[model samples]
Every structure is written in structure tokens, then in C-alpha cells.
Target: SEGKTSFGMSIFNLSNAIMGSGILGLAYAMANTGIVLFLILLILIAVMSAYSIHLLLKSADVVGTRAYEMLGLRAYGQAGKIIAACVVTIHNIGAMSTYLYIVKIELPFVILGLLGKEKDFGGWYVDGNYLITIVSVCVILPLALMRRLGYLGYTSGVSLLCMVFFLISVIFKKFVMECPLKSIDPYSNNGNKTLDPRVMSSHINSDFMATPFTTLMRSHNDSDFIPRFIPVMISSHTAHDCREAKMFTLTPEAIYSIPIVAFAFVCHPEVLPIYTELRKPTKKRMQNVANISILAMFIMYLLTAVFGYLTFYGNVEDELLKSYSASDTLILCVRLAVLVAVTLTVPVVLFPPSSSGFCDKWHR
Candidate 1:
């Protein structure tokens, strides 16, 4: 395809991972740094992404090798070969959370989707690394045997298609379905389990019903109050102009403090890998990829954060995924498609790390 490693892959990666829980992390990110600080952090994160690309380009020029191998030369000299392996391994370890989150969410669904009519795997608890070990043996082992990154090329195309399906479903569902994640409730009786009682109650606090309830009041004036609020407080005219800027406390005594709460799940880490990845090999592509990617990510962040701010801003515990959970059938269908795209792309994002980790562990 034209996009074998082109703009399509960049969009697919950004669409898949840039989203997910990252939007929720950002809700708190804003709450942590405030809107101004949040933007600063975003630019810094984006810079780091750009820098990674710059580093790879420079490295590739020196010894004339791919980014992965270049890391080895930078670190190892003649041992660059070994260093490269270690670098890949370390990268994967950092990305372990992404791997675990995607698998846990998707694998459970697979077992249920294929067999939901027949049975549920919820009861299966073999304990320990038994599951991980088993999966590595049954699943990882086969994929590991593959020859190279090029070997997996076709799957990447499939993953992009899956990503498009995901985008379409969510966008369509948003307009059609009436439920917002906050209002949809399941009933619950046990501490261990429960279902929303919304079905029984005549009253529902639908976001549709609540958006007009009065937007959370941000003061038209931001100058004086911002200094006392937010964690990374700074002197800036922008902060002053941001009327109704939220005032977050910086005191240790403010148990369950707002600034800390905001930064808690702020997902700044995701942009790091993506920025570098795109910069390294794909830097020469159309500028549209960069502009479009930034715009999409920003818009995606805004919609979900608004929901989170409205839904759980003060209560804590990020609301990105929680809001998705609120979406009705159409939304649910979108969620399902997103789940598939994320699951399939797992190997692509995690592969470098997995290869590096396997080699490093093998030597040590």
C-alpha cells in the first residue's frame, strides 16, 4: 500500500494510542497544570517527541542504520549490537502498561465475545504467572518466531482499517446515542458487584439533561486566583487572561489535593514515544500528517476532557474511559471497534520493546 509506513500508519498510531485513556489522563493533566500549564506540558512533550526523531536521524546518518540499531551504536561502540538490543528491551518495559492494559481489556472480551452465549471466563483463575507464562508460550512464542518488522507489514495495514472502523463507529455513535458515560448507571447489590438502578428510576441525570444545568463556573478573571491554584504555577499573562481559571491548592494539608489530583493521571508519557517514532523515519512526509495529527489529538482531548471536567473533575479518578462506558449501543459498538484496533496495534507499538527485552534478558 502507499502507506506501508507512511502517513496512514502515523494517523493510525495517533488515533489508536493518542486516545484511549490518554484523554482521561489529560483531564487530570489540565486539572494539575491548569489549562496553561497543561498546554506547556503538551508542547514540552511534543518537543521531546521531536527531539527523539532528531536524535534518530542524526544517529542513522552516522553509521547508516535503523533507529533501533542506532541506539546500540550510540551506547555500545563495537558493542552497539548488544546495546541496541538492550535499548529495545528497556523501551518495551516502559510500554509494558500499554501492553497489559490492551491485553487485559481485549483478551477478556475475546473470551466473552466468542463464548458469551455459552460461558464466561471470569471464573477462571489459575493464579500467578500461569496466565502470562501460558500466553507467552501459546501466543508470544509464535509471533516471536517471525523473521522481521517487514514480516509483520500486512498486519499493520489491517490494523489501520480497524482504526478507521473505530473512528467511524465512535463519531457516528456520539451523535445518535443519547447516553453520556456519567448518566448511564448499572444496578448493584454486592460490594463485589452491582448493576445500575437507572432502569428502575424514572429520573436520569443524562448529560443531555445536565449540560445546560449551568457550566462549571470559571471566573472571567484569572490573574489573582491562579497563583494560589494549580501545581506548576507560573507568572504568565495567559494565565491572567484565562478568566475563571480553576484554583487548585498547593498545600500538603489539602488532603486529596487538587493539583496533585490533576497531575495524578495526566498522561504525558504517551506522546514521548509517538513523537520520536514519527520524527525518525517519517519526517519527510507531508506536513499535513503533523498538522492533522496535532489537530485531531487536541480536539479529541477537548471533547473528552469537557466530559471529564463535567463528570468527575472534582471527584477524582479520571473519566475518559468511564465516559466511554456511558455511551449507548452505538457508542458501545464504537468502543468495541476501538478495542479491536488497539488490540491489534499492540504488537506494533510493543514489538520494539519486546524484541529488545527478550535479547537483553537472554544475555543477562
Candidate 2:
């Protein structure tokens, strides 16, 4: 009891595990899948994830051991144990790498923004590799050294707050940011026909208001996976059109979005450890913790995907934040907040393998 974690902290830890850099890609995934299809996929994944946890907890109970590897051992001897350990190690290592990669990509811009320099300004400080090294040593390493998984709960709470800020910023930006982004070039200037901005804006306003209910569903053949440009009365105003909304899509891009959505919910490996540390730990209680955590992340993920997709429409980039202007103060702050969230998350991701004895040598 002395070293156990409360339900609230356990939720925080598990919530942090559920959320990561994967969230930034949800909008892009939505762009490919469309609003309706994406929501359906998301709800299905969340339900499946919870059900998977239920099976895991049930298995651990029957095996009379809390360790995932031990459950494997009971089921299939040493081979199962090793396979389990390897799978956990590989998955978590990949998760850690993804988190660090976010740090590498975004840290430079964050530092540059703080220093009032151009996003492209040159310096060793702005070098992603160098910044990642510094962050690894100064931030992640120390946190990863903690012996108990429960200790990281405080940092996890902080990390969740950062993501909440990111979510709020995305929702706020949806209202403030307009479509057919002025920063993006609609047409190449290489002796090509160009439309006047004033005329285009007027067309957007008039056509969008007059034909508010007009819907067009572009037909796509099974082999036609390429994104096609559909001509509309107004050039870029089509983004706001109901016709652009695809209830379902069979494109290769939509298929590719499946993995992104699936992987975004991978917190199963971390479940047992948190369950073991849970105060007055019981199968039913831990299940409640897992369910609540998944639900919270589900809300955040859905809101983030919907609002972010609405903001950028089909033009949304894989990394949603990258699609925004770096010079915007609000976006800059969101960037830093994201950096903090992911940086703190690396240590939590490291815990599964490290506790499994995968990092025994380093600890010794």
C-alpha cells in the first residue's frame, strides 16, 4: 500500500500512454477517411482496444502472474516468454523513437521561435540531431532512471495538460483560420492562368452562401486511388462544400490511414504495469481505470481530428502542426507544448522494456 498509485494518478499515467505524437496525425488520417468514416473507425478502434485490455487482464488473472512475459511463459514456455519480451521491447522502442523524432523535428523551430529568429535560421542549436541529443541527456535520461512506474504519474499529468492545450488551440484556430489558406499558392506562377484574390474571395462568399446545400459526390473507380481535383463554381470554396465530404472512400490513402488510427490506441503493453501499481489493485478496478483513460483520450482524439480536419480540409499535412504558420504566436506556443508532452512521454514509453529487463545492463 505504501508504494501504490491512486485511481486518479493511474488514470493520468495510462492516459499519457494512450496519447502521444500519434495525435498529430489524426487530422491527416481523417482527411483521407472523411469525417463520417473516420469517426466510425475511431469508435470501433476504441471499443476494440478496451476489449483487448479486458482479455489481457483476464489472462493475467488466470495465469496467477502480473508480468506479461510470465503469462506468455505459462501459455508456451520459454519461447513464448522471449517472444513476448521481444514484442514489447520492439513496440516500445518504436514508440520512443517516434516521440524523439517529434522532438528532433519540432525542437529547432521552437528554439528559433523563442529567440525571435526565422524558422529557417541556421545554427547548431537549431540542428534537430543536436537538440535531440541534448533533450535525451538533460530531460529523458533522468526521468527514465526512476525505479517505480508510479513516480512518472506526475510528469504524465503535466504531459496530458500540454496536450489539452494543443487540443484547445486546434479548436480555437478552426474558427479563426480561414480556408484556401493565403500562405499556400493555389496556382503555379509559371505562365499559368491565375485568378484574382478579390474575385476568388467574392466567389467563395457568394457561391458558398447561395448554394449552401449543394452536394456533389465524385465517383471513384476501384483502381482510381489518386486524389482528383473536382471543378466547382468557386475555385477553393469547394473545401467548404458538402460535396467534398466523402462518407466513405476506397482510396489507397484511406487504407493506409487504418494503421495510423489503430496504432494511436496502443497502450496495452503499459496496462499491466500500471495495474500492478494501482492502489488496492483488483481486476475490476484496473479495468475501470483503463476504460476511463481510453474514454478521455477518445474525446480528445475525436475533437482534435474533427476540428483539425475542418481547419485544413483535404490540404492537411501528415503532421497537423506543420500545416500551420510557424510565425503565429499561438501555434508557436502549441509547438513548445507538444515538444514538452512528447519529451516527457519518452520516459514512460521506456518503462515497459526497461522493467522487463531489456535495459538491465544500462540500469546496472
Candidate 3:
């Protein structure tokens, strides 16, 4: 098939769309719903996401429509087209807003790290609005102007590479580093135990409804593998301790985790456009591209969640990176990588909104 985009490029584009800052929240999700349940939800979400994409591809093939707006038009007439555009526009706007927020919050930290200045510069230049403007002009605007989506494959590839570094760093820190590393002074040795209980916890809050379902297990002890798993509860604790605490309770916290996972897997809007650009535009081929992308994200998500949860069992923070000591140089590098990834991702997200407008104009 003489498709415009190679399979590799297509996978990169889709994967870039699939993986976002939502990965940062997976650890917190796991902390709320124990390691086993978290993995189960992760797998279930991944499968459902992939299946949805498959259905989308099959439908597109049936109607010979490559644009989501067009697909809506075929099924629901003018109303469908308008609704699709509205939905895509709204979703893309929300996603871009998140990336904008990520850039606003992270750029200053990256700047400080580069300058080796811990305290704020005490100037307007360090202000988040100023940083967002600078990034918008210098980084995002140029990419958003590109007329072709294929060119973004390179940026997407680079962005995914940066995320890979973030993932690797998380794994490295989790397994290779000791619990009470003197460098991370917050986690000092306890009175009796060599490690602080806050460092790892076995306690899950009772506020949640507990379940006996078990799927997988991993703990601080590399050699120990136990199947006696219970649903985990998410709560804020002043104490940072690692205990073998297991409580299975279904609460609002578990319900809250769903949006993050859903947000992480949200790439449906980008699917049809990518399909249009694929080298072989067969439904099977597009499905293959999506499957590869989803599988890649699934693995990365699991690894990040498992390692992060293992590192900070019950006391996992909302932002996984926030759970770590800011002073850690290694973490600082990962922070920079995440900053770059999210910044570059702005244009990729902006594509859907722009395309929706363009298609609407052309069709009209």
C-alpha cells in the first residue's frame, strides 16, 4: 500500500497522543486502588481504548470517511457534523489547557534547575504567565503552523523519547536506590526499623469498601511475591511510613481515579486523521498501528504506576514527581524531560481543533 505515512511514523503520532501528563497521576491512582487493582484497571482501560479505536477504524472503512467530522455527518447529518466538531474542539481545548498548565507550572522549575537557583528570581520574568507566553511563541506557535501532520511525526518521536527517559529514570530510582538514601533527608532511619514507616506503608484507609480480588503484587522486597492482595485506599497522611498495610475499600477516591486513566488513554480524536495519513489505509493496518501505540502506552503506564506505588506505597502524592525530593538531581533531569514533552505536545493537540475548523470550512 502506497500510504503517505510509514507504520513507524503513524505509531509515533498515535502514541504521542495516547501518552500524556496523565501518566503522572497513575501512581496516585495505584495508591488509591492498591497495586493489583490498579493493574487490572490499567489493563481493562487499555483493552477498551484499543477496542474503541478498532471500532472507529472499521466504521471509517465502511463509510470511506477519513475525518471524524465526516463520519459524524454521514451518520447524523448536519447535526452530527456540528456535534462532532464541537466535541473534538472542546476535547482538544481541554487537553491543550492541561498541557498549558503543565508548561506554566514546570517551566519555572526547569529554569531554576538550569540556573542552579533554588529560590524564585523575584521578578516578573519568572512569572507563569510570562513563561507560558514565551513557550507559546517560541515553541508551540511554530509547530502549530505546520500545514502537514506528517511533519509532526518527528516532534512526536522526540516527545515519546523524552517520556521514555522519564519512565527509565522512575524505574532506576525505584529499584536501584535505597529507601533511606541520605541525600533524600526527609526519609531518615526510624527508631527501631532501619527505614522510616513513612517511606513505605501497608495501611489502606478503612473509609473505602474493601474487595478480595487479587491480580498482581510487587513490594520493596524483590524476592517476596504475595497474592494476598486487597483493594487500596487513597488518603493524605502527615506521616510518611512504609508498612504492609492492606485494606480494600471502594470509595470516591477509586471513582476519582477513573478520569485520570480515561484522560491518559484519550487519543480517539486523533485516530481518524492519523488513519488518513497512514501508508496502508486498510482498517486492519490502522488497527495494527493503534494496537502498537496502545500496547506501548499500556506497558509504560504499568511500569510507572507499579514502580511509583512500590516506592511510595500508601502515601503516594497526586503528582508522582512531586512525591520525590525536589533536590534530587536525577529527578530534576526527568522533570526537564517531562517539561519538554508536555511543551512539544501542545501543537500535536492543537492539530485537532485546527483541523476541525478547516474541515468545517471546506465542507461548507
Candidate 4:
């Protein structure tokens, strides 16, 4: 696999596939859910991502070809081919959908912050060349157009870096750090007025149950009284549905910051390319690449979660930039840059799917 694939390739593929617009949506997931659910979500995603890698490796071993190339063909023949095609197409579509959503969320700010302009938003009509669609196009077409994964060698590096910058910009704020309301929006005074002692005391003294998160949890579970459930059944309920819902939300939150803590656990097909592409001089390097990628992502995600919590505590937005999307310069540059980057990124994702399709026909 060294000369044929290499560890480096795996890293790039992993980064590209896993590191999409998922980052922006995570903060809200964490905040809406709570820390416990967040941790649970993280573990689930990691396990899934790990299993994904294992399955791919196992598939390669069994099929004597890459996971995408023959997993479908071996399992079900031509029908398998169609299913594989759908899987790849769906992945591409999902990637595009995610890109569109994130860009739609991030673009307004980039435009405003950088170019001082705004584009149509999620208010309606997303399919008509929305940001998400455009973003996906940008990420996919250019890279898809490359004709070979080898060409993406450097662009992957930049994407990795961009992911880093994204993490730093969002997180790094656990060291820094809110709530409010009144007829009177106690927080609505525009930040220039002093807090009312009575209100402050009332708020602080209020029951923890009143907290937005607490209220939401109670409301969602419809359980005002917790910790009283049967121990055996706890695993049956909280461990499954509650846990899945919780972590899935935070998995994204924890993705970039605690990169390692979480990256190992994604469930997407993109991880294969990363593992396949590794430099693989030794087991140590292989582990190191995985280790560093996860570590970097962990730190990045942790910070993002923190920043999101601090920046918009009571009402955390999945797309943190939305508030300023209308005038965010950095957001604009990023959108435009990603528009370019995605061009290179999509092909990198599509190749495996295409080859899978060809093999299915050839085998027939």
C-alpha cells in the first residue's frame, strides 16, 4: 500500500470526507443537548468511524481491491452495483447538501465581513443554486475534474490547514465566557445598562430546571424527575435512543477540536480514501497519522464548542456566522475560497464511486 496508496493519501481523504460543513452545525447540537449526551454522541461517532476503517481494511483483504471498488460487486452482483452507485451518489449528494447548508450559513457572513454583501438565504428556494448547492459544486467539481487522486496531494494540505484555522477561530475560548430575559428582556438593554440586583439574584437563585438546556431536556424526555429510573432499564432507554440523539448532535461539536477524540468515530465512506492513501512507512507512522489527525481535530472541536457556548449561550446558532453573514469579510473570503477548494475536493470523493460503477459493469 506504500507506493500504491500511502498513509498521506488516507490523511487527505479522511480530512476531506470527514471535515465538511459538519463543524458548524455541531455547536448547537451540544448546546441543545447537554454535556452527558455530548460525550455519548462523541463515543458513538468514534466507534462508527473506527468500525468504518476496519470494515474497509477487511473489505480490501477479502476482495483484493479497494473497499469502494468491489464491496458492492462481491456482496450482490449487478444489484449490488446499483446499490453501490446509489451509495456513492448519495455520499456525493449528502456532501453537496452539507456544503450548501454550511455555506448558506457561513456565506452571508463571509460576504458581509469581506465583501459587505448578502445573498438569498434559507428563507426559501434552496435548490435553485443555493449556497449549499454552490458550495458542494465548488468542493466537488474541481477535484473531480482532476482525473486522478494523486493530483490532490497539495490541495488536501490546504484543506487540512483550513480545517485547522476553522477550529482555532471557533474554539480557543474555554478560557473565556451568559443568560437573560425580561418584559423587559434583561439582556435587551443593548449591553450599556447595568443589571438589576433583584433580577440577578432572582435569576441566579432560580431553579436549575429553569435553565434553557434543563428545560429542553425535561421537556424532551418529559421527565422532570431523573436518577430514579430502574438501573437495568437505564441502558435500554437512555443508552440507546437518548444517547444516539445526544452524541450525534455533539459529534460535530467535538469533531474539529478534539479531532482525535472524535475523528476516529465518523461513519462516512470518506475515511477509506484516507486510510488507503497513507504513506505507511511503518505501523508507527500509520498510527501517528491517525493519532495526530484525531488529536488536532479534538483540540479544534473542543475549542469550537467552547467558543460557540460563550459567544451565544442562551441562543447558540449552528452557523455562528449567521448573525453577521450580511457583513462578514472573513466569511466571504472563506466562501469564495471553498468555492475554489470544493472544485478540487469533489473529484477526490467521486473517483471511488465511479470506479465502483465501472467494475460492476465489467464484471457482468
Candidate 5:
């Protein structure tokens, strides 16, 4: 009965919600749980996330309650409503904080890159405290002020494009370029030796399973038949022929990676609203939207993790972009991409909480 969102816009909005700052950590997740296991976990989480959305939609359809908090009220009365509201509030607050934190830490770098000033500009724009505030006022506040959820889809599409740029950059950097930091690893002799291309390619070919993404459809543990595949970093400056590559051990600590991946795929709070706003408003179409959105994110997440892990190997940092040397111009653009994407994504995340509160007040 309200303004309806078209199928494509719905897909873009949901996908934007599904993809977030959480993706930057996925390479680290892959590092913790080798390339093989990371794919498995990603698929598993995506399947579960999609199934959960289906259940939420089915519940809403059967109960005739489209809002998440309202669905909570239908299922469990006032207590359910309160619990749902609080969960949505807490979830959105955490998400908003993370988005703001991304702006805080990354905005200065983006501005510095644009200004061509490698150093701080010594003003409010450079300060982490004020940077987020400035971005919130200049960027997020306008998007958040929109009266309808569907109106934000245009910005959401742009945000998704930013992430797409990031994914492309990771893939491009992996094949076409070498990070200058590779030659500068302190562990390498003299910090000036170039990796022999032949030696590097040989190791990449030999340990094909564990390195990069050639082994995408395969799985192996240290205890598996192949066992103990190490990533070699060869130094051309050395008279010695081959250096021992660092073996990325399959550790028992894979548990830490699951939550972050799970966090990345979260779009439950926004699901009901999107479903409600769908033009046809059928359960089947909404389910398709959820599936398609999750599938798109699945591909992006796996690619980001695979390429990023391949690029850094055992040295993948918590934030994949941070793994790049600060001076790399290509990486600076990718950083800006993430900042813009997250900046726009904040309002999409913020909408559910604020709208849910309004719905609660109206119900009263």
C-alpha cells in the first residue's frame, strides 16, 4: 500500500547491506582458516543466512506482520516486541559504530591521498574525532533523512559499485602487480632482494592447492594427504638458489574466523522492510531477492578473500587493504573506495533502527 521498490533496486539495497566493512577482514579469516576452509565456511554461512531470511519472510507472511519488531509482537506479545526492538537497536548501533569507525580511521587517508599531502593537514578534517562527525553531517545525515527506505537505493547502488571496485583492485593487484613490500620483508636478506619470478611461479605452481585460488574447489588440511604446503619468498640477490617459504599452518584456531564472516553477511534486520517494500510483495519474489543478494555477496566475499590472501600469503593483515604499503597509490584509491562505500552504507544500516522506533511509537 506504500511506495514500492523495484526488483533490481531491492537487490542492490539488500546486497549493499550484506556487504560491509566486515569484508576487509575476510583475508585475515582466510589466513586463519586456509583458503580451502574459508570457502567452505563462507558457503555454509551464506546458506544459513539465506535460510534464516526465508524463515523470517515465511513467519512474516503467515503472521501478516511485515516489520521485524511487529512480527516479534505477533509471535510473542509485548515482550517479543521489546526484545526485537532492543536487538535491532543494539545491532544497528554496533553496525553504525563500525561504519563511523571506518570513516574515522580511513577518511584522513582518503583526504590525504586526494590532497597529495603525505602528512596531516593539521585541522579538523585530519582529526579522527572530527572526521567522522564531518562525514556524518556532510554525507550520512542527508541519506538518513529520506522519508522512505526505497529512496536510499540509489545511494546503495553506488556503495555496491565502490565495493566492486575494491574487489577488482584486489584481483588486478594480485596478477598484474607486486606489492613493493614483498621485497622489503625484514626476514629476507638485506631487505633489497627481488623474488625470482621463476622461483615464485614454481612455488605457486607446486603448492597450487594452498596458495592463491587455483584450489578453489578443493580442500586440504595439514593432516591431509598433501600436507604442509609452504609459501616461498625467493630472493634474487642471494647466491643461494632457494629460500624456505613460510608454511601457512592449518591451525586449530579457525573458530575466530566464523563470527566475522557471519557478521559480514548479516541483513536480517533490513529483510522484512525490503520485503514489505517490494513491488509485487510475494514471498517467492522476496525469497528470490534474498537468495540472489546472498549469492552475489558470496561470490564477492570469496574473491576478496582468495585474491587478497593470495597476494599477501601468510602475511595477510586483519584489514586486507592495510596489508598494502601506505605509499602505494593504487591501494590508496581502494581505501577511498571502501570509505565511500561504508559512508553511504551507514544510512542503509541506520534506517532499520530509526524506522522500527517510529513504528513502535505509532503502535503505542
Candidate 6:
């Protein structure tokens, strides 16, 4: 009771748990599902997540236990408890892995960008495996080792701020980036037109033109390579062709998009712990926390997905930040913010599984 967290801190922790590396991929999901359908799915998932939290809290009150596994045990038997614990453990582990993987992939690039050597990837400093290991040992390990979830409230607040900065940067970039109208030269072989190699490379390697030729061209120096391949390369196009954002449609990839949208609201596993640590723990108060956190995240996720998808339209990458030019100073700063946000989130995601393990041992 002495270390109980106030309502604001509890909200911070829950909000951090809800927002993670999943935000980076929402734009791609929106691209696949279209604007109207994506908004519908997002709203549905947020409401479902809040309702599930309410049910979980009600069940906990009835059983007189805050432990999720114990709730399962009361409802069923040993098998139910085991199943509940295993499911929570597996889901949190996957979430933690995803956060760390973002660190691994993006940290090196952030370091290189800060050093003004974005192309320099030859050192151990730029190695993703090494960066992730150092970060885990230096940053995440200490935060994860804290005995109380409340202690993470401060860090969670900072993480949420970083995401807000990221969201704002995304909206700003949408206005500044211009789509190249004549991104491809169709009559190059007929000696009537020519293409800028830089423009061509940007369109092929960075935009939505994902083809075998684009993949092959990325391996070579663009200036030297594009001239030789200009005669045969006719399939290449630009983001101008993809400027129309879909309003009401779904691609075959919606199968994957649905899961992405659903899982983006997964703060259920962290709800009870936050509730347990609340300054004035009550079902009504905790439900309010859940509602506020989900609502906050829903707005952030929607703004991020909408602006990000609008910027790239059909050309948006799985990672929204990757769709931008790496040399853009603002985007580089955004990359850093995103990297920090995900890195700090690792500790929050790590808590559920670790606490579950400690609970099991204490019970024994």
C-alpha cells in the first residue's frame, strides 16, 4: 500500500503497455484494408479490448483474486490455470521479442544517422546483434529487474511522449514530401527521354515498386547500374501512380491486417497488475483507467495510421518510418524517437511473463 501508484501513473503504465512496436506497422495494415474499413476494424478492436478488460476485472472481483491464473483456477481447475499462465507468458514473450527486434533493426541505423554516416555500416557499432545485446544489458535489463510495476511509470510516460513526437513528425512529413509526377521514362530506348538515376533509385528501392529488378538494382551502385539497365527497365513507376488512397476496399492481405489491428490493442495482460498497484484500487476506477488508456491509444493509433498511409498511399512499407528518405533530418529524428520508444517498451512487455513466473514460484 505504501508504494501504490496514483491514477495518472497507472494510466501512464497502462498506456505504455498498449502502445509498442505495433504502431509502426499500423499504416501498412491500413494500406491493405483501406481507410474506411481500417477505421471500422480499429474502432471494433479498441472497444473489444476495453470490454474484455472490464470482464477480467469483474471476474477478479468475484473470485477475490487479482492474479489472472488464479481466476482461471477458480473458474476451472489446474489445467485452466496452466493454460492461462502459458497463454499470457507466450503472448508477452512475443511482444517483447517484437520490441527488441525493432531495436536490433533500427538502433544501428539511428546511431549511424546521428554520426552523419548513414552509409557506414562496416563497424561493430552498426551490427544489429551487438546493438541489441548492449541495449538489453544496459537499458532494458535494469528496468525489467525492478521489483514493482509502479517504478516503470516514469519511463512509460517518456515512452508515450516519444510516440507523440513520432506521430507529429509523420503528420508534418506528409505536407513536405512531394510525389514525382514523371517518375519513369517509358521512351528511353526510343531516344526521346531519359531518367534521373537518383529519382529512379528512390522510386525503385524506396517506393512501392517491389520487383525482382528493383531487388537486383539495390545491390549495385545506382548511377553505374541504371544506365546499363535503362533499355530494358519498363516496369518501374513512381509514388505518383499510388497517390490515390483507398476509402472502401480490402485486399487479399486483410487476413493479415485484421490480426495486426486486433493485436495492436492488447493491453489486457497488463491491466490487473496496474489495477493492483493503483492508489485507490476499485473495479470502477480501474475500468476507467482501462477506458482512458484504450481511448488514448485508439486516437494515437488512428492518427498515426491515417497520416502515415496518406503520405505514402499504396506505397507504404510495413514499417511506416522506412517509407521516408533516410537523409531527411526530420525523419532521422523520428527514427530515433521510434527506436527509443520501442526500446523502453521492452521492459513493460517483459513484466507480465516475469511476474507470472514469480507468482508460480511463490505459490509453490
Leading candidate by TM-score: 2
The residue-by-residue lDDT of candidate 5 on 1-364, one tens digit each, is: 7438999999998999999899999988887887777777888899999999988888888998788778778889999988999899899889989889878988887778777887896977788888778788989998887767898889999999999999999999888644322333322454333334324444443212222312212235633232123333322322221222222446565677889887878999889878878898899999999999999999999999888877766556788887776777888888988889999899989888878854546435
Error of 4 at 175 (Å): 6.6
Write down the lDDT that model 2 would get: 0.82
Off by over 4 Å in 1: 1-7, 10-21, 74-81, 94-97, 105-283, 286-299, 310-312, 323-335, 353-364
Model 2 clashes, total count: 0
- Candidate 2: tens digits of C-alpha lDDT, residues 1-364: 4338889999999999999888999998998988889999999999999999999999998888878789889999999989999999999999899889888988888888888897666789999989999999999999999988899999999999999999999999988865533232323342122434334444344333222222323346644233233322222344345325555655568877899899878899899889888899889999999999999999999999988888877667788998887789999999999999999999888888888855668777
- Error of model 1, residue 241, in angstroms: 20
Mind giving the per-residue lDDT tens digits that candidate 4 earns over 1-364? 5434555665665556555555665565566655556556665665565555555666665676655636677888878867876777677666555544545664455544453335544443333346556655655555565544556767767776766665554543323321211112233353323334234444443322122221111335664433222111001121122213233343344444354335333434554444455554343454455555555555555556556654554345555544222334454454556544444455555656654545446335
Deviation (Å) of 22 in candidate 3: 0.5
Sort by lDDT, best first.
2, 6, 5, 3, 4, 1
Per-candidate clash tally: 18, 0, 19, 59, 0, 0
Per-residue lDDT of candidate 6, residues 139-209 (tens digit): 99999888789999999999999999999998988888654121233334532234455464554344433
RMSD values, in order shown: 13.5, 9.0, 11.6, 12.5, 11.2, 6.3
lDDT of 1 by residue, 1-364 (tens): 1223444565555444333434435555454445554555555555554455455555554655444654465667748766666655565455555655655654544444444333444455322234445555665556545534333445545554654554455455445533221332223232222323223233332212222221122346843221111111111122223223344433233333233333322222232233344433444442344445555655555554443443333332443344443324444454555555544445554555544434446434
Candidate 2 regions with alpha-carbon error over 4 angstroms: 1-3, 119-121, 182-246, 249-252, 358-364
The alpha-carbon deviation from the true structure for residue 166 of candidate 3, after best TM-score superposition, in angstroms, is: 0.5
For this target, which candidate reaches the highest lDDT against the unseen true structure? 2
| lDDT values, one for every candidate | 0.43, 0.82, 0.77, 0.50, 0.77, 0.80
The TM-score ranking, best first, is 2, 6, 5, 3, 4, 1
Instruction: Estimate the overall C-alpha local distance difference test score of candidate 3.
Output: 0.77
Superposition TM-score, candidate 1 onto the true structure: 0.52
TM-score per candidate, chains pooled = 0.52, 0.84, 0.80, 0.61, 0.80, 0.83
Per-residue error for 87 in candidate 4, Å, reads 1.6
lDDT-wise, the better of 2 and 4 is 2
